[model samples]
Target: MGREYRCRIQGGPDRDAIRQLREGIRLDGQVSRFERIRHQGGRGANRWYEVVVCEGRYREIRRMWSAVGCRVNRLIRTRYGDLVLPRSLKAGQLRELNRAEVKALLRSVDVSHSGRRSSASSA
Candidate 1:
């Protein structure tokens, strides 16, 4: 599961464009689920969208949006796999991941890395 995002696009997307984007995403076959996509609001030529896609599918989501005549100007991943970017963590700040967080992150993408121990032992 993932949270929604508020994205800024070059042009406002109408309902028909959103429909086309949905179709494109489905055709891409990389998305397991596109939970939601809506025009939250906009100003001038910039459009705001609230989108919820399956975890690990943000790239596909961006591609689909582009294919449907929307150029994404900015995107912020509000959530990923039960982890939310903390409000206090400003840009460029670093936060070390705890063991559980690391484990969950790896599990989200179905990846298992045994770390540098195996290489060290071999060396």
Candidate 2:
């Protein structure tokens, strides 16, 4: 769940461009859908759309938009799966957690093999 991503509003002024970008990504990447977000920038009169992708590859989305001559000015990863950077954590600061917290994470995984083993033993 530590996957990285590049997020952007593809294409220029035409509002429909966002829709096109969404469709293109689905077709090219073979994904069914991606979550869309809207935000108001400090200097802007209109709203902006942000696209989210799970797979992280540097500038992957930006390069895709650049293929059509569109520029992506803002790119930031706001979330990484279940882990969200704490608001208190600044740019260069870091937080170190104990080993128990790390091992607890593995308990969260739902492996299908466990279910199969239980069923076979009960038979």
Candidate 3:
């Protein structure tokens, strides 16, 4: 599973570029899930707008945008796994999850059911 990110970027990318992204492009390995959000004045590849991606590959977002010729001005992760970052949370503030929240998050992944063990795990 991959994390979801909403990006606000500078530079404009057009339909063909966006489609190429959604269809999948090779970043580090491969990255997909590119969605261009609709904004009031959004038209061509020169405005700041939102693009959503769901891939946690190393530097995938920035690299992907750069590949398509868009410069990411801002990147925000609104969701990770089953946890959603609250809108009320302010910048530079940290919130520790309560015990229950932590447990729920761990449970959401079901690591125990992933029977294949790595060499480190087998040791």
Candidate 4:
């Protein structure tokens, strides 16, 4: 139902690998590494692969696979800490914080539009 593959480089994965993967998917859906880069076990052992999914709807990554005759099987989100939506924030739901919290947040922002004149002006 699915395919899985791993690529172990000599120094582990890096931004270039990630970029190549993204570009490959964007252009042709095929995912692979640079020829010069070495992988563990070599050949079938280290080479990446594709998968065939039965589902109709696919995600952003899956859409890229359409160009390469391969389907993404395993996807690990590495930036969930910064982007993942918290359950506390609900759709169409807006809540206000306490006065102290509001003040703290506003204190950081430079609101020159407050229109408040300086306390000490020319005599």
Candidate 5:
């Protein structure tokens, strides 16, 4: 599933630089999708981005931005596929997903029922 991010970066990265970063992600064969939504704040430094990749590659987003010469000051994952981080869930707090929610999440990521059952059973 893809994720949306609001990132605070140090340098003002132009469109060309952002394109280069996208290319880098593609070259690495890691990212399935990469998009820069917009840059706000002074000098267009802070950016909003959306990316789709195989699971467990969230950290790579920071690395890719850093490799392109932008230091990420803040990175907030606002969405993961159909799951949005609830405003009520404060940092360090956890929320358990109900059965329907869990099923939807698994469907979003294309996980088979057997896979889900096996994982659940193991847990």
Candidate 6:
């Protein structure tokens, strides 16, 4: 697993397209744990989706939605490895993880030590 995203998307992809997406999406890596959480009240039939994907492939989420004829209105990184973004945080904010959390996050990627600090450390 890599970055987990909670995204708000609009546009109504028909059943077939939904099924196609549910089957799997081929980005840089496979899109996993893809699920529509709920219909958030907004214009354009906005809905939320949770998905897990490894590696960034240049706006891969937008590309994935576009492939299914959907439009992503908002995309937020909810989790990375075992680290979950706290709800208490607001937009454009950051938080430092605890030692245990840091360890868990590192373990998730099978890295005991990374030469560079991770952006996940200040999420």
User: Model 4 reaches what TM-score against the true structure?
Assistant: 0.25
Q: Write the per-residue lDDT of candidate 1 for residues 10-121, one digit (tens) a residue.
A: 8776787777655545545553445778777788998888787765454665676776788888877766676777767766776898898888876665555854334434
- lDDT by residue for model 4 over 3-56, one digit each (tens)? 222322222234555445444434335343222222333343233432222222
Candidate achieving higher TM-score, 3 or 6: 6
Root-mean-square deviation of Cα positions for candidate 5 versus the true structure, in angstroms: 5.2
Q: Residue-pair clashes per candidate, as listed?
A: 0, 1, 3, 1, 0, 0
Candidate 3 C-alpha RMSD relative to the actual structure: 5.1
Give the per-residue Cα lDDT of candidate 4 at 16.
Answer: 58
Ranking by TM-score: 6, 5, 3, 1, 2, 4
For model 4, the stretches where C-alpha displacement exceeds 4 angstroms are 1-14, 17-86, 112-123
Report every candidate's CA lDDT: 0.69, 0.49, 0.66, 0.36, 0.65, 0.70
Backbone clashes counted, model 1: 0
Model 1: residues with Cα > 4 Å off, grouped in runs: 23-33, 55-58, 88-93, 97-123
Name the lDDT of candidate 4. Answer: 0.36
Model 3, position 88: C-alpha lDDT score: 83
Estimate candidate 6's alpha-carbon lDDT, on a 0 to 1 scale: 0.70
lDDT of 6 at 27: 65
User: How do the predictions measure up, each by TM-score?
Assistant: 0.62, 0.51, 0.66, 0.25, 0.67, 0.68
**lDDT tens string, model 6, 1-123?**
567787788876677776766666776565632443333345558877676666546787778878888998888888766788887888899888888987787676655475555566545
Q: Which stretches of candidate 3 lie over 4 Å from their true place?
A: 29-55, 88-93, 112-123
Q: Which stretches of candidate 2 lie over 4 Å from their true place?
A: 1-13, 26-34, 42-48, 67-69, 87-94, 97-123
Largest lDDT belongs to which candidate?
A: 6
lDDT by residue for model 5 over 1-123, one digit each (tens)? 666776777786777777776555543565533544455555454554444444436477677777677778877767777888886777688889889888898777667777754454345
